[model samples]
Each structure stands twice: as structure tokens, then as C-alpha cells.
Target: MSQMTLEKRFGQSTVFVASTLMENGGVPESATPESLLKEAIHVISCGYEDKTDWGNEIGWIYGSVTEDILTGFKMHARGWRSIYCMPKRPAFKGSAPINLSDRLNQVLRWALGSVEILLSRHCPIWYGYSGRLKWLERFAYINTTIYPITAIPLLAYCTLPAVCLLTGKFIIPQISNIASIWFISLFLSIFATGILEMRWSGVGIDEWWRNEQFWVIGGVSAHLFAVFQGLLKVLAGIDTNFTVTSKASDEDGDFTELYMFKWTTLLIPPTTLLIINLVGVVAGISYAINSGYQSWGPLFGKLFFAFWVIIHLYPFLKGLMGRQNRTPTIVVVWAVLLASIFSLLWVRVDPFTTKVTGPDVTQCGINC
Candidate 1:
């Protein structure tokens, strides 16, 4: 088939992407339809050979710092604190689509690399993708699902006053600080991730912004939703979902150091989200107290400081009173996910001096 026709076929839908990845044998054991689609776009890209590896670029050291060197160094100094955060993608274990099962490794490597550019830190292949496009993809991921979900918790915050007014549950009354803390956390995540993405992609914000938010929203939300699903499974003691790229969904049943590495890799998402939120909580509470009890933002303060009180303490007790099972881990992971999202808000890079990272922005013989 012509390259143009092949591209069209691959772009058909999530199912098509799934089928292609599965057919290529690159399908991850835990990959989701959304991740599969993304992999297809990159691997079979009819254009964009000009992409560069993002990790090699630095903010602006006059060709001094690489994207990976600068951002990773800074974030590492930050202890990669975002690693402690939560609501990461659960492990997906669905069946791989039939037919295409040949190009599995290439597709798996590509998908895995994409995850690294956006989330993974240990993967050396991540920096291979062009700085420009890699970051554009990451930002698209951030502004879409990660940020909006942070806003959902705001609904809880917005309703706090109403909850107090309506239920009279508090002799002291309270507002919801949950949302604000979450919002701040999400903001931080955005800032950190964005900075890195920019340095990696090497494309100016002007060029990135030229792309619409809707597509960003669609790509990002779809990606995270899948991840969020996988995260839920992690807490359930299930196998990690490798659904994003399907090189060969064949369960080798062969556990190796890589499995440990895969697991160790997970530390990045959870750890990043956890620490950032904790910091935000400290920051929020201090900020709230400084403003006095008069500020409704304190409600978020309380929620952040004492979600055990706000959610588990109250709800767990209520569940006990009603003889219900209150799975706190669910709530815990969700909270961490919220914090994970919060980190997205802070995503940013120092700017890379390299020309292109790779597939998305590689300059190897392609246009610079």
C-alpha cells in the first residue's frame, strides 16, 4: 500500500491503532487503545522526519546543556519529588488486537520511549525523540486530562460551603480546600513537565501554541484516562499494564530485572505526585493560616492538611457505622493522582541547545 494510504488506515480509530500495534507484535501486555493510537501516529508518521531528541537539548547554555541534562539535573536536585504523587495509570491487561504482530519491538520501543518523554525518567531512549515534538506531545498530555481532572476536585471545593450550609455537619463549618490544593499541585506538575517538554521538543511556545487545545485535550485526556485505569489496577496487586505499545502481547511469563525496573520505574509517577502535593499542602496551609480563618481557601487547606479527617476519617467512620467497606487505598491513590496532576501545572524546561531530539524533532539528515 502507498504510504499515504497506509497512514490513512492507521489513523482510522483506536481500534485501528490497537490492531496495528498488535499486528506489529509491539503491543504491550498492558497497553490501552488510546496509547496504541498514539504509537501508530509516531511509528508510521508519513512526515516529521525533522524531529530531534529532546533529552539532549538544554535550556540555553550556548550549546552547553542538553535538554535531558538540564531538566533532569534540575528535577533530580528537586529529588524528582513529583515521584511521590499519585493517580497514575493502572496496569492494563486486555487482549491485543489481532492480525498485525510483526513489528512489535519497534512499536514497543517507540511507545515506551513516548512514555519516558512524558513520564519516564530512567529510559535513555526517551531523549532520542526530537525535543520539539516530544515536549509538544507532553504539553498536550498535560493541558488536557491532567489539568482538567485537577479542576474536577474543585467542584468538591466549590461545594464545601454548600455542604456546610446544607448539612450543618460542622459546628465550625468549612469550605473545600481540596480543589485548590489539587489545582496548585496540578499547576506545579504542568510547570515542571512543560519546562522539560519545551527543552526536549526545542520548538518555541509560539509554534506549540499554534496547535489547538482541543486536540491536545483529546490526546492527553485519552492517554491519561488509560494510565489512570492502569494505576487503579496497581493498587489491586495486578500485573502492570503494558498496553500502550504492543510488540507482542505474548506473556513470556519471564520475569527479569526489567520487571523490577518496570516496577522501579513506577516510582517516578507516584513519587513525583506525592511529594509535590505534600509540599502544596504545607504551602496551602501556611498560606491559609497567614490569611486567617476568614479565608474560605482554608477549606482546601483543611482538606489538604487533613484529608484523613475530610475523607477517610469521616467517610470511613460513616461506612463503619453503616457496615460498608471503605477502601482507603482507592481514596489514597486518587489523592496521589490529584497530586500527580498538580505536578503537571508546574511542567517546564530550561531550554535545549541541541537541534533536534528525534522522531518528533530529529535533525539527522532531515530538515533542521
Candidate 2:
């Protein structure tokens, strides 16, 4: 019964509404329980339209997993406006996922939904151009759907420092004096924005920092997975299962659930990322120690970026560790296995050494 309610709420609401609307030519003026049952029976036999037109034109848009966002986008495209309101008293409250695993799963569902909309035909980037969607409004919608794509660049940004440290090649180009000023200005501006928001909104610095941490954690893990999942569904007709996040149980009052780990494929990317960054930090420090003070400057730059990634993932790392022996053995094995492979690959590649000519090439008359 709960499953039926969930399907009706999130997945099948469009179908239900469409069935009634199309059958009655609009909402009926009056109805009885008997008539309702008959209508239900009729709908059960006759399916609803799957396309954007017809039934979906009225209720929640049905093509994507995120019907709420799609519905709002469609409404806005037709010139409907929305206003933000803050009441003096609390208007609504609900249970939220408190555990690390549940929280990550919740984030994964949202990211997956956003990815679905992004790849769908109703994507705000290309769709709604013919409608009355204002430029700013359209841009906002575009940002909502497009944000999952940022995981790609975020992952790269997180990985590049480690790669540079391992290879002994600081390939990142140095900017000019003018560019340096611009870079510093941009960094300061971000700090200023955070400061102003905290000051005006009465939000704590710790809360602000936690938000930043979760952004990186979710980006590298859930959002990254969502992108690939979305691509697979779109290109190969493969579908991802929609797993609802588990709600906090009564025992969660002590927050013991917060440390509990659950095995999920979503854990793989972030775990691998964490291991690589840690390895990078160790390898970088070792390299700097062996090379002496002359190498310290470049090492500082590399370490700064690598440490930044590590700091953002600290909370996630803590969750993985859990309390005492409660941590899952599977997670430990996978993380260690991946870390070992990465370390071995870095050693075998030995990018710091110059290539030596083979004896066969040296013996050849012509240059090989």
C-alpha cells in the first residue's frame, strides 16, 4: 500500500490525472464513490499518453524522473510566475535522512533526476525557447538541470594536482602578473560572498563550511554517477532503478545512525578519489623530502590543491571509518584494492625518469 502511494506520488501521478482529465473532458462537476470506481477501472484498462502533449500538458510532466522541476519549467515557459515567501512561523516539517549512507542516497536520487531532465527533450537549455520563459528564469532552469555536469570538471580539478605531484610535472601554466591579480580577486570575491551571506542570514561559519564540504562529496560521488547513468539510459535504453532514501528510524535520536555505512556503487568513486588524494599527499611529501628545499615551492602548490580536496572529503572519510569494528569489510577491501592499483600504476609509469633507448634501436642503422 505504501509502495502504491509512492508510485502515485512520484511516478504515476501524471497517468492518474491524465486518465481522469481525458475521460471527463476536465474535472467532473459531481461524482459518487461508484462512479469513481468505474473511472478507476476504465483507467486501469486504458493507458495514459506518454508524450509531453495531451495528458502531461496539464498535470506533472512525465518524461523525466523529476516531474516537479519539469512541471515548473513547463509552467514558467507559459509565463507563469513564482514568488518566494518566508512565513513568520514554520509552515511545513518532514523527516530527513540523517545517516551518511541515506544522505548520500538522497543526493544521488536528486542528481539522477536532474540528469534525467538534462538529457530529456524538455532540457531547459534547448527547450522552452519558443515560449515566454524570461531570460533570467530560463537561465535559472538551465543551471538547475546542468549542475550535475559540473561533476566532470570538479573531478578533474580534484585529480589534476595529485597527477602533477605523481608525475613531477607541474603542467599547469603560470599566469601573468595581471592574471594573478584577477585570480586573487576572484578568490577574495568568493570569500566575501560567503562572509556577507553568513553575516546577513545569521548562518554560522561551520554550517557554511559543511555545505561546501557536501558539495564536493556529492559532486565526485553521486552527481558523477548520475551523469554516466543518465548517458546509459539515454544512449543504450538501459534504465537505473529509483531507490528512495531510507528515513531515520527512532534510534537515530542519538545520531548513531550517522556513522553507519551501507554498501553502494555510489561509494566507489568518492572512495577511489579519497584514496588517490591521500596517496598523492604522501607521495608528494616524500618526493619533496628527497629533492630538498629547491623542490619545496612546487610541492607547496601541489599539496595545497591536494589538501583542499582531502579537507572537503574529511566528513565522508569519517563516515566510512565508522565506530569500532562496525565498518563494512567490503568497503575496506575495495578502497585498499583500488589504492594499491593506483600506487602500482604510478610506480610502473615512473614519469620522472627520462626514457632510455633500447639496445635493438641503438643497433639499428636507421633511427628507430
TM-score for each prediction?
A: 0.20, 0.77
How many clashing pairs does model 1 include? 130
Best by lDDT: 2
Best by TM-score: 2
lDDT of 2 by residue, 1-368 (tens): 36454345323443345443453344444655677776667545435434324344545676777779999999899766677756779678777888777787788788888989988888898998889999999899899999999999998898777787777777457789999899899999999999999998878999999999999999988899889999999999999887778787665675666666677767777788888888888888998899888999988888888889899999888877657875577777787798778767876887767998666855875775
Tens-digit per-residue lDDT, 224-300, candidate 1: 34344334443454433344433234564332212221212222222333334344445455655676877554355
The 10 consecutive residues of candidate 2 with the worst lDDT sum are: 46-55
Candidate 1 stretches with Cα past 4 Å from truth are 1-263, 298-368
Q: How accurate is candidate 2 locally (lDDT)?
A: 0.78
Q: What's the distance in Å from true for residue 115, model 1?
A: 10
